[model samples]
Target: MHENEISQIVFDSGLKIHRNLGPGLLESAYEECLFYELSKTGLLIEKQKAMPLVYENVRLDIGYRLDLMVERKVIIDVKSCESLNDVHLAQVLTYLKLSGCRLGLLINFNTKLFKNGYKRILNGDVAL
Candidate 1:
Protein backbone atom coordinates (compact mmCIF):
# COMPACT_ATOMS: atom_id res chain seq x y z
CA MET A 1 0.00 0.00 0.00
CA HIS A 2 0.97 3.63 -0.47
CA GLU A 3 2.46 5.63 2.36
CA ASN A 4 -0.59 7.91 2.63
CA GLU A 5 -2.94 4.97 2.85
CA ILE A 6 -0.79 3.36 5.53
CA SER A 7 -0.63 6.67 7.38
CA GLN A 8 -4.41 6.97 7.39
CA ILE A 9 -4.67 3.49 8.83
CA VAL A 10 -2.24 4.35 11.58
CA PHE A 11 -4.08 7.60 12.31
CA ASP A 12 -7.45 5.89 12.54
CA SER A 13 -6.00 3.18 14.73
CA GLY A 14 -4.59 5.78 17.09
CA LEU A 15 -7.95 7.53 17.33
CA LYS A 16 -9.69 4.33 18.23
CA ILE A 17 -7.09 3.45 20.84
CA HIS A 18 -7.28 6.90 22.39
CA ARG A 19 -11.05 6.88 22.34
CA ASN A 20 -11.24 3.61 24.17
CA LEU A 21 -8.35 3.97 26.57
CA GLY A 22 -8.21 7.74 27.12
CA PRO A 23 -4.86 9.16 28.24
CA GLY A 24 -2.32 8.62 31.04
CA LEU A 25 -1.58 5.05 30.07
CA LEU A 26 1.85 3.66 29.53
CA GLU A 27 3.36 3.41 26.06
CA SER A 28 2.98 -0.35 26.15
CA ALA A 29 -0.77 -0.05 26.75
CA TYR A 30 -1.22 2.18 23.74
CA GLU A 31 0.95 -0.14 21.68
CA GLU A 32 -1.18 -3.15 22.52
CA CYS A 33 -4.38 -1.34 21.75
CA LEU A 34 -3.03 0.15 18.56
CA PHE A 35 -1.82 -3.24 17.44
CA TYR A 36 -5.24 -4.75 17.95
CA GLU A 37 -6.95 -1.80 16.31
CA LEU A 38 -4.74 -1.96 13.25
CA SER A 39 -5.13 -5.70 12.96
CA LYS A 40 -8.89 -5.37 13.16
CA THR A 41 -8.68 -3.01 10.23
CA GLY A 42 -6.95 -5.75 8.23
CA LEU A 43 -3.57 -4.09 8.03
CA LEU A 44 -0.41 -6.16 8.35
CA ILE A 45 1.45 -4.92 11.38
CA GLU A 46 4.64 -5.63 13.30
CA LYS A 47 5.30 -4.76 16.93
CA GLN A 48 8.63 -4.50 18.68
CA LYS A 49 10.25 -5.40 15.42
CA ALA A 50 13.98 -5.64 15.78
CA MET A 51 15.89 -3.71 13.13
CA PRO A 52 19.60 -4.25 12.97
CA LEU A 53 21.84 -1.20 12.80
CA VAL A 54 24.83 -1.16 10.47
CA TYR A 55 27.96 0.79 11.20
CA GLU A 56 31.19 0.38 9.27
CA ASN A 57 29.91 -2.88 7.78
CA VAL A 58 29.18 -4.28 11.23
CA ARG A 59 25.65 -5.07 12.34
CA LEU A 60 24.65 -3.70 15.73
CA ASP A 61 21.54 -5.41 17.00
CA ILE A 62 21.28 -3.91 20.46
CA GLY A 63 20.28 -0.37 19.51
CA TYR A 64 17.33 -1.17 17.25
CA ARG A 65 13.74 -2.18 17.69
CA LEU A 66 10.84 -0.46 16.02
CA ASP A 67 7.76 0.12 18.17
CA LEU A 68 5.44 -0.64 15.35
CA MET A 69 5.53 -0.87 11.56
CA VAL A 70 2.30 -0.75 9.62
CA GLU A 71 1.91 -2.28 6.19
CA ARG A 72 5.70 -2.01 5.96
CA LYS A 73 5.25 1.62 4.88
CA VAL A 74 5.20 3.60 8.13
CA ILE A 75 6.93 3.50 11.47
CA ILE A 76 4.87 4.11 14.60
CA ASP A 77 6.49 5.01 17.91
CA VAL A 78 4.40 5.07 21.06
CA LYS A 79 5.24 7.34 23.95
CA SER A 80 3.43 8.08 27.20
CA CYS A 81 5.72 10.80 28.44
CA GLU A 82 4.40 13.99 29.97
CA SER A 83 5.30 15.89 26.84
CA LEU A 84 7.17 15.44 23.61
CA ASN A 85 10.47 17.13 22.93
CA ASP A 86 12.84 17.43 20.02
CA VAL A 87 14.51 14.27 21.27
CA HIS A 88 11.26 12.42 20.68
CA LEU A 89 11.04 13.68 17.11
CA ALA A 90 14.67 12.86 16.54
CA GLN A 91 14.19 9.38 17.89
CA VAL A 92 11.30 8.77 15.52
CA LEU A 93 13.29 10.19 12.67
CA THR A 94 16.14 7.86 13.50
CA TYR A 95 13.74 4.95 13.57
CA LEU A 96 12.41 6.01 10.17
CA LYS A 97 15.91 6.19 8.78
CA LEU A 98 16.92 2.86 10.22
CA SER A 99 13.76 1.17 9.08
CA GLY A 100 14.10 2.67 5.61
CA CYS A 101 10.62 4.09 5.93
CA ARG A 102 9.75 7.52 4.56
CA LEU A 103 6.94 8.26 6.99
CA GLY A 104 6.66 7.88 10.76
CA LEU A 105 4.19 8.69 13.49
CA LEU A 106 5.23 9.66 16.99
CA ILE A 107 2.22 9.33 19.25
CA ASN A 108 2.38 10.40 22.88
CA PHE A 109 -0.44 8.95 24.90
CA ASN A 110 0.08 11.19 27.91
CA THR A 111 -1.63 14.24 26.48
CA LYS A 112 -5.16 15.38 27.19
CA LEU A 113 -5.81 15.72 23.48
CA PHE A 114 -4.53 12.96 21.27
CA LYS A 115 -4.31 15.27 18.29
CA ASN A 116 -1.79 17.41 20.11
CA GLY A 117 0.43 14.42 20.68
CA TYR A 118 0.44 12.93 17.21
CA LYS A 119 3.35 13.93 15.01
CA ARG A 120 4.02 12.97 11.42
CA ILE A 121 7.67 12.89 10.52
CA LEU A 122 9.00 12.50 7.02
CA ASN A 123 12.54 11.63 6.00
CA GLY A 124 13.36 14.42 3.57
CA ASP A 125 16.97 13.32 3.12
CA VAL A 126 16.13 9.78 2.16
CA ALA A 127 14.64 8.80 -1.18
CA LEU A 128 11.22 7.31 -0.53
Candidate 2:
Protein backbone atom coordinates (compact mmCIF):
# COMPACT_ATOMS: atom_id res chain seq x y z
CA MET A 1 0.00 0.00 0.00
CA HIS A 2 1.03 3.64 -0.41
CA GLU A 3 2.27 5.73 2.47
CA ASN A 4 -0.84 7.86 2.60
CA GLU A 5 -3.13 4.82 2.77
CA ILE A 6 -0.99 3.28 5.51
CA SER A 7 -1.05 6.61 7.30
CA GLN A 8 -4.83 6.81 7.21
CA ILE A 9 -5.12 3.37 8.76
CA VAL A 10 -2.66 4.45 11.42
CA PHE A 11 -4.67 7.57 12.18
CA ASP A 12 -7.91 5.60 12.46
CA SER A 13 -6.27 2.99 14.63
CA GLY A 14 -4.76 5.66 16.85
CA LEU A 15 -8.07 7.43 17.20
CA LYS A 16 -9.81 4.23 18.22
CA ILE A 17 -7.09 3.47 20.76
CA HIS A 18 -7.20 6.96 22.23
CA ARG A 19 -10.95 6.88 22.53
CA ASN A 20 -11.02 3.47 24.18
CA LEU A 21 -8.09 3.93 26.52
CA GLY A 22 -8.16 7.68 27.03
CA PRO A 23 -4.92 9.35 28.07
CA GLY A 24 -2.24 9.26 30.80
CA LEU A 25 -1.19 5.73 29.95
CA LEU A 26 2.38 4.86 29.07
CA GLU A 27 3.50 5.24 25.46
CA SER A 28 4.19 1.53 25.21
CA ALA A 29 0.58 0.75 26.07
CA TYR A 30 -0.72 2.88 23.23
CA GLU A 31 1.94 1.54 20.90
CA GLU A 32 1.02 -2.06 21.62
CA CYS A 33 -2.65 -1.36 21.19
CA LEU A 34 -2.03 0.49 17.94
CA PHE A 35 0.14 -2.35 16.75
CA TYR A 36 -2.63 -4.82 17.54
CA GLU A 37 -5.24 -2.70 15.78
CA LEU A 38 -3.08 -2.24 12.70
CA SER A 39 -2.24 -5.94 12.64
CA LYS A 40 -5.89 -6.73 12.03
CA THR A 41 -5.71 -4.79 8.76
CA GLY A 42 -3.27 -7.33 7.25
CA LEU A 43 -0.63 -4.64 6.76
CA LEU A 44 2.96 -5.47 7.56
CA ILE A 45 3.93 -3.75 10.80
CA GLU A 46 7.15 -3.72 12.74
CA LYS A 47 7.44 -2.62 16.36
CA GLN A 48 10.53 -1.10 17.90
CA LYS A 49 12.39 -1.63 14.69
CA ALA A 50 16.11 -1.09 15.08
CA MET A 51 17.71 1.31 12.60
CA PRO A 52 21.34 1.52 11.73
CA LEU A 53 23.11 4.79 11.11
CA VAL A 54 25.67 5.31 8.39
CA TYR A 55 28.35 7.92 8.86
CA GLU A 56 31.33 8.57 6.60
CA ASN A 57 30.58 5.42 4.62
CA VAL A 58 30.69 3.30 7.77
CA ARG A 59 27.51 1.70 9.02
CA LEU A 60 26.93 1.94 12.74
CA ASP A 61 24.28 0.41 14.93
CA ILE A 62 23.54 3.54 16.89
CA GLY A 63 20.43 2.25 18.62
CA TYR A 64 17.96 4.26 16.58
CA ARG A 65 14.52 2.66 16.45
CA LEU A 66 11.14 3.36 14.95
CA ASP A 67 8.18 2.75 17.23
CA LEU A 68 6.25 1.23 14.37
CA MET A 69 6.99 0.90 10.65
CA VAL A 70 3.86 0.29 8.57
CA GLU A 71 4.35 -1.55 5.28
CA ARG A 72 7.92 -0.24 5.35
CA LYS A 73 6.66 2.96 3.75
CA VAL A 74 5.60 5.04 6.71
CA ILE A 75 7.14 5.41 10.13
CA ILE A 76 5.04 5.86 13.26
CA ASP A 77 6.65 7.40 16.31
CA VAL A 78 4.47 6.76 19.29
CA LYS A 79 4.67 9.21 22.18
CA SER A 80 2.76 9.90 25.38
CA CYS A 81 4.12 13.21 26.44
CA GLU A 82 2.67 16.30 28.03
CA SER A 83 2.70 17.79 24.55
CA LEU A 84 4.19 17.24 21.15
CA ASN A 85 7.17 19.48 20.57
CA ASP A 86 9.85 20.27 18.04
CA VAL A 87 12.02 17.47 19.37
CA HIS A 88 9.30 15.01 18.57
CA LEU A 89 8.97 16.32 15.05
CA ALA A 90 12.71 16.25 14.57
CA GLN A 91 12.86 12.67 15.76
CA VAL A 92 10.30 11.56 13.21
CA LEU A 93 11.96 13.53 10.47
CA THR A 94 15.30 11.97 11.33
CA TYR A 95 13.76 8.51 11.22
CA LEU A 96 12.21 9.22 7.83
CA LYS A 97 15.59 10.31 6.49
CA LEU A 98 17.32 7.25 7.85
CA SER A 99 14.68 4.85 6.67
CA GLY A 100 14.12 6.60 3.34
CA CYS A 101 10.41 6.92 4.09
CA ARG A 102 8.34 9.77 2.72
CA LEU A 103 5.85 10.03 5.54
CA GLY A 104 5.66 9.71 9.30
CA LEU A 105 3.10 10.05 12.04
CA LEU A 106 4.06 11.49 15.40
CA ILE A 107 1.26 10.45 17.67
CA ASN A 108 1.31 11.69 21.25
CA PHE A 109 -1.42 9.99 23.27
CA ASN A 110 -1.39 12.32 26.24
CA THR A 111 -3.88 14.98 25.44
CA LYS A 112 -7.52 15.55 26.26
CA LEU A 113 -8.24 15.35 22.51
CA PHE A 114 -6.59 12.85 20.21
CA LYS A 115 -6.46 15.28 17.33
CA ASN A 116 -4.36 17.68 19.35
CA GLY A 117 -1.78 15.01 20.01
CA TYR A 118 -0.95 13.89 16.51
CA LYS A 119 1.25 15.42 13.83
CA ARG A 120 2.00 14.39 10.25
CA ILE A 121 5.58 14.87 9.12
CA LEU A 122 6.78 14.69 5.55
CA ASN A 123 10.26 14.10 4.34
CA GLY A 124 11.81 16.01 1.45
CA ASP A 125 9.53 16.33 -1.61
CA VAL A 126 6.86 13.84 -0.84
CA ALA A 127 3.59 14.37 -2.69
CA LEU A 128 1.43 13.84 0.39
Candidate 3:
Protein backbone atom coordinates (compact mmCIF):
# COMPACT_ATOMS: atom_id res chain seq x y z
CA MET A 1 0.00 0.00 0.00
CA HIS A 2 1.10 3.57 -0.60
CA GLU A 3 2.15 5.84 2.21
CA ASN A 4 -0.99 7.90 1.75
CA GLU A 5 -3.17 4.83 2.09
CA ILE A 6 -1.36 3.74 5.23
CA SER A 7 -1.76 7.24 6.62
CA GLN A 8 -5.49 7.16 6.07
CA ILE A 9 -5.76 3.90 7.98
CA VAL A 10 -3.79 5.33 10.85
CA PHE A 11 -6.02 8.40 10.94
CA ASP A 12 -9.13 6.25 10.97
CA SER A 13 -7.74 4.09 13.72
CA GLY A 14 -6.89 7.14 15.77
CA LEU A 15 -10.42 8.48 15.41
CA LYS A 16 -11.87 5.19 16.53
CA ILE A 17 -9.65 5.16 19.59
CA HIS A 18 -10.42 8.76 20.54
CA ARG A 19 -14.15 8.28 20.20
CA ASN A 20 -14.18 5.23 22.41
CA LEU A 21 -11.78 6.41 25.10
CA GLY A 22 -12.50 10.17 25.08
CA PRO A 23 -9.72 12.45 26.36
CA GLY A 24 -7.58 12.97 29.51
CA LEU A 25 -5.79 9.61 29.08
CA LEU A 26 -2.05 9.41 28.94
CA GLU A 27 -0.34 9.59 25.59
CA SER A 28 0.87 6.03 25.98
CA ALA A 29 -2.66 4.80 26.40
CA TYR A 30 -3.69 6.31 23.11
CA GLU A 31 -0.47 5.10 21.53
CA GLU A 32 -0.95 1.52 22.62
CA CYS A 33 -4.57 1.57 21.64
CA LEU A 34 -3.66 3.00 18.27
CA PHE A 35 -0.96 0.40 17.92
CA TYR A 36 -3.40 -2.38 18.74
CA GLU A 37 -5.95 -0.87 16.38
CA LEU A 38 -3.33 -0.56 13.67
CA SER A 39 -2.25 -4.14 14.20
CA LYS A 40 -5.72 -5.39 13.31
CA THR A 41 -5.52 -3.50 10.03
CA GLY A 42 -2.98 -6.07 8.78
CA LEU A 43 -0.37 -3.38 8.16
CA LEU A 44 3.24 -3.57 9.30
CA ILE A 45 3.87 -1.37 12.36
CA GLU A 46 6.85 -0.74 14.63
CA LYS A 47 6.32 0.90 17.99
CA GLN A 48 8.89 3.14 19.67
CA LYS A 49 11.38 2.64 16.83
CA ALA A 50 14.85 3.91 17.59
CA MET A 51 16.18 6.50 15.19
CA PRO A 52 19.85 7.38 14.89
CA LEU A 53 21.54 10.38 13.42
CA VAL A 54 24.44 9.92 11.03
CA TYR A 55 26.61 12.97 10.82
CA GLU A 56 30.23 13.38 9.66
CA ASN A 57 30.18 9.71 8.69
CA VAL A 58 29.42 8.71 12.26
CA ARG A 59 26.31 6.75 13.25
CA LEU A 60 25.23 8.38 16.48
CA ASP A 61 22.50 6.59 18.38
CA ILE A 62 20.86 9.56 19.99
CA GLY A 63 17.69 8.89 21.91
CA TYR A 64 14.99 9.39 19.31
CA ARG A 65 12.17 7.00 18.58
CA LEU A 66 9.23 7.28 16.27
CA ASP A 67 5.96 6.81 18.13
CA LEU A 68 4.77 4.44 15.45
CA MET A 69 5.93 3.63 11.94
CA VAL A 70 3.25 2.25 9.68
CA GLU A 71 4.41 -0.09 6.96
CA ARG A 72 7.80 1.52 7.56
CA LYS A 73 6.63 4.28 5.30
CA VAL A 74 4.68 6.77 7.39
CA ILE A 75 5.97 8.18 10.66
CA ILE A 76 3.12 8.55 13.15
CA ASP A 77 3.67 10.82 16.17
CA VAL A 78 1.04 10.57 18.87
CA LYS A 79 0.70 13.60 21.07
CA SER A 80 -1.63 14.45 23.95
CA CYS A 81 -1.44 18.14 24.63
CA GLU A 82 -3.84 21.04 25.03
CA SER A 83 -3.15 21.78 21.39
CA LEU A 84 -0.83 20.84 18.58
CA ASN A 85 1.96 23.35 18.11
CA ASP A 86 4.99 23.99 15.95
CA VAL A 87 7.15 21.80 18.14
CA HIS A 88 4.92 18.86 17.49
CA LEU A 89 4.95 19.59 13.78
CA ALA A 90 8.72 19.91 13.80
CA GLN A 91 9.00 16.64 15.68
CA VAL A 92 7.27 14.69 12.94
CA LEU A 93 9.35 16.47 10.31
CA THR A 94 12.57 15.65 12.09
CA TYR A 95 11.54 12.02 12.32
CA LEU A 96 10.77 11.96 8.62
CA LYS A 97 14.16 13.43 7.81
CA LEU A 98 16.03 11.05 10.07
CA SER A 99 14.15 7.98 8.88
CA GLY A 100 14.40 9.07 5.24
CA CYS A 101 10.65 8.84 4.93
CA ARG A 102 8.66 11.40 3.00
CA LEU A 103 5.32 11.23 4.72
CA GLY A 104 4.15 11.51 8.32
CA LEU A 105 1.02 12.03 10.37
CA LEU A 106 0.87 14.07 13.57
CA ILE A 107 -2.17 13.10 15.60
CA ASN A 108 -2.83 14.94 18.84
CA PHE A 109 -5.54 13.17 20.82
CA ASN A 110 -6.13 16.04 23.27
CA THR A 111 -8.69 17.92 21.32
CA LYS A 112 -12.45 18.27 21.43
CA LEU A 113 -12.61 17.24 17.78
CA PHE A 114 -10.14 14.68 16.51
CA LYS A 115 -9.93 16.26 13.07
CA ASN A 116 -8.62 19.50 14.55
CA GLY A 117 -5.54 17.72 15.85
CA TYR A 118 -4.61 15.90 12.69
CA LYS A 119 -1.70 17.10 10.58
CA ARG A 120 0.27 15.66 7.70
CA ILE A 121 3.90 16.65 7.32
CA LEU A 122 5.96 15.75 4.26
CA ASN A 123 9.51 16.12 3.07
CA GLY A 124 11.71 15.14 0.06
CA ASP A 125 10.02 14.36 -3.23
CA VAL A 126 6.56 14.58 -1.73
CA ALA A 127 7.22 18.11 -0.54
CA LEU A 128 7.53 19.27 -4.10
Top of the candidates by TM-score: 2
lDDT computed for candidate 2: 0.92
| Local accuracy of candidate 2 as per-residue lDDT tens digits, 47-125 | 9999999999999998998999998899999999888888888899899999999999999999999989888899987
| Pairs of residues clashing in candidate 1 | none
In candidate 2, residue 122 scores what lDDT? 93
Better of 1 and 2 by lDDT: 2
- Point out where model 1 deviates above 4 Å: 125-128
> Which runs in model 3 stand beyond 4 Å of their true positions?
125-128
In angstroms, how far off is 98's CA in candidate 2?
0.4
Root-mean-square deviation of Cα positions for candidate 1 versus the true structure, in angstroms: 1.7
lDDT of 3 by residue, 16-75 (tens): 998998888999999999999999988889999999999999999989999999887889
- Each prediction's RMSD over C-alphas, in Å, is 1.7, 0.8, 1.3
Ranking by TM-score: 2, 3, 1
Each model's TM-score?
0.92, 0.97, 0.95
> Which 10 residues in a row give candidate 2 its minimum summed lDDT?
1-10
Q: lDDT tens string, model 1, 1-128?
A: 88888878788778878888899887898999988888887878998999988889998998588999988889999999988999999988888788778999899988888899898899876543
Report the number of the highest-lDDT candidate: 2
